[model samples]
Target: MDRIDVHQHLLPPGYRAALEANGVVAAGGRELPDWSPASAEQVMAGAGIGSAVLSISTPGTTFLSDPAQADQLARSVNDYAAELSAAAPRTFGFFATVPLPDVDAAAAEAVRALDTLHADGVVLLGNARGVYLGEEGQEALFRVLDERSAVAFVHPADLPGPAVPGVLPFAADFLLDTTRAAYLLVRNGIRQRFPNIKFVLSHGGGFVPYASHRMSLGIFTQTGRSPIEVLEELAGFYFDTALSSSAAALPTLLTFAEPGHVLYGSDWPFAPEPAVHYFDAGLAEFPGCDEATRDAIRRTNAAALFPRFGAVPAPVPEPPLLTRLRRRARTRIFRVIARAAGRR
Candidate 1:
C-alpha cells in the first residue's frame, strides 16, 4: 500500500539552533530527535511512505519570549520546508509553523505560507504559551484559517503545568494536552463556526475517542445542549494514527472516527524507527480494517484532503447562518461557565 504520513516532524537547522539558544534540550520529557532531508527520505523509503507532510514538533516558537524572535524563527523554518517540498513535490510536503500567542503575526505568517509558499497546511501547538485553541485570543488566527479553508494540524506541546516527578510529559500528558484542545474546540463552537478549516488531531485524537461520552456529558451539563449533538461534533474532527495504531487503540479510533476522517501518521523522528515500524505493522495487520479502509487510511483520505497530492476534495455544505448564530451563542455561554469555574 502507498502510505502518506501526515504526522511527521522536521527539525530545521535554524529551529534546532533556536532550541539550543533557549537552553531547551527536551520536549515532552524526551530529547529532540535529529533530522535531515536525507535521513527523512531514508526513513520514509524504509517505512513505505510515498509522501510525508512535515511540521515542527512541540514547543513551536513558544520558547521564545519575544514575539519578533518567534516570528523570525517561524518564517525561517517555513522557508526551509517550502524549499524541500519544491525540490521533491511528491516525496515531501509541509505544514507551516506560526508564531502563536502573537495572534496577528501568526495569522500573517499562515497567509504567506498558504498563498506564497504553498504549504500543505499549518501546524498548531495544542496550546501556545498559555492560550489554548478555543480561547477568544485565538479568534483572529482562526478567522484567517476559516477564510482560506485551511487544514490545521493540532500537535501537543508540554503541559502548562509543571511535569510530575519521574513521569515524562510525552508518555501521558501529551495525550491530555491534545484532548484538552479538542474539547475546547468543540465547546467553543470552533468546529461549527469555522466549518471550512479542517482540524486533524494527532495521536488518534489523544483521549478523545475513549473519553468522548464523559466529555460530552461535561459539555451538556454546562451548555444544556444535547449530549448526542456534542458527541457528533466531537466525532467530526479528523484523527491520525501515530503512536495510536495499536490493536487496543485502533479499534476505538476506527469506530469513533467518521468514514474518511482517519488518516495514516508515522509521528516519525520523534517516534523512533522501531516504534514507527511496530505501529505501522499493527495497522497493516489489524483485522478490523478491510482492504478499502486500509487503502483509505494509507493514501486516499489524505489525497482527498490535500488536492495537491492528486485527489479532488469533496465539497462540504455550509451550515445555515441561524444555526451558526445559535451555536456561537451557546458556545459563548459554555465559555463563561468555564471561566466561572476558574478554567482557562
Candidate 2:
C-alpha cells in the first residue's frame, strides 16, 4: 500500500534563522535546523514515504513576544509552505500557523491560510499561556475551524507548572499538556458544539489512552457520564503515530481507535530515528491487521484528512537514472546479505 505520512514538519528558512538568532530551542534545548524542502524530500525518499504534511514544530509563533512580529512570522511561514506545496505538488502539503496570543489576528490568519493559501489545516499548541483550547476566550478560533471544516493539529507545548528540577520538558510535560487540552475540550462541550472541525492529537493522544479510565471515573462522579460514552466521543478524534510506537502503546491505541482514526506520522528532524523505528515496530507487532486496515492507517486515512494528497498521482514509472540506481543498490545489498548468511 502507498504510504502517506500525515505528521512531518518543515522549518521554513526564515523561521529557523529567527529561532537561532533569538536563542530559542526545542524540548531538548537543541537548536533548530534549517529544514528546507530539498532536505525534507531527501528524508521522505530515503524512508520510502510517499507524501508528508508539514507543520511548524514546537516554539511555533508563540516565541515572538511582540504581537506584530508574531503575526508577520505566521504569515511568512504559511506563505513559504504554500510556495513549497506549489513547487512540489505531490510530495508536500502544510498546516498553517497562527499567532495565538492575539486571537483576532489568529482568526484573520486562519481565513487567509484556509481560503487564500489553501492550507490543509491549522496547527496549534495544546496550551497557550496556560489557556487550553476550550477556554472561554478561545471559542472564536474553534468557531472558525468549525465553520471551515478544517482540521486542527494539536501538539503539546510547555505550560506554566511545577516540573522536576532537571527533567526534560518533553519527557512527561508534553503528554500532560495534551491530556489537559483534550480533557478541557471534552468537559467544555467543544466537541459537541463544534463537531465539524476535526481534531488530530499528537503523540498518540498523549496520556488519554492510559488515563481514560480515571477520566471516566471523574466524569461519572462529577458530571454523570459513563466511561463508554467518553471513549466513544474520543474515538471520533484522530491520532498520529509519532513517538508512541511501543508494543504496549500500539496495541492499546489499536484497541481504542479504529484503523481509520490512526494515521502514520514521523516527528521528523527532532527525533527521526525514533519515529522511523517506531513505525517499523508497529508494522511488525500488528502483523495480524488486514491489508485494508494497514492501508488505511498508512495512507487512506491521511488522505481523507488532507484531500489534496488524494489528487496528487503517485509516482509513475521511475526515470531511467533512478531505475538504474535502484538496481545497483539492490544488487549490492543482496550480495552482502547472502555473504553474511553463508558465514553465519
For candidate 2, the TM-score is: 0.85
Clashes of each: 0, 0
**Candidate 1 lDDT by residue in tens digits, 240-273:** 9999999999988877766788999999898999
What lDDT score goes with residue 183 in model 2? 83
Residue 95 in candidate 2, Cα distance off native in Å: 0.6
Error (Å) of candidate 1 at residue 213 is 0.7
Error of 1 at 34 (Å): 1.3
The prediction achieving the highest TM-score against the true structure is 1
Segments of candidate 2 deviating more than 4 angstroms = 311-344
Residue range with the least summed lDDT across 10 consecutive positions in model 1: 315-324
Q: TM-score for every candidate vs. truth?
A: 0.90, 0.85
lDDT (C-alpha) at residue 18 in model 2:
84
For model 1, the superposed segments whose C-alpha errors exceed 4 Å read 313-344
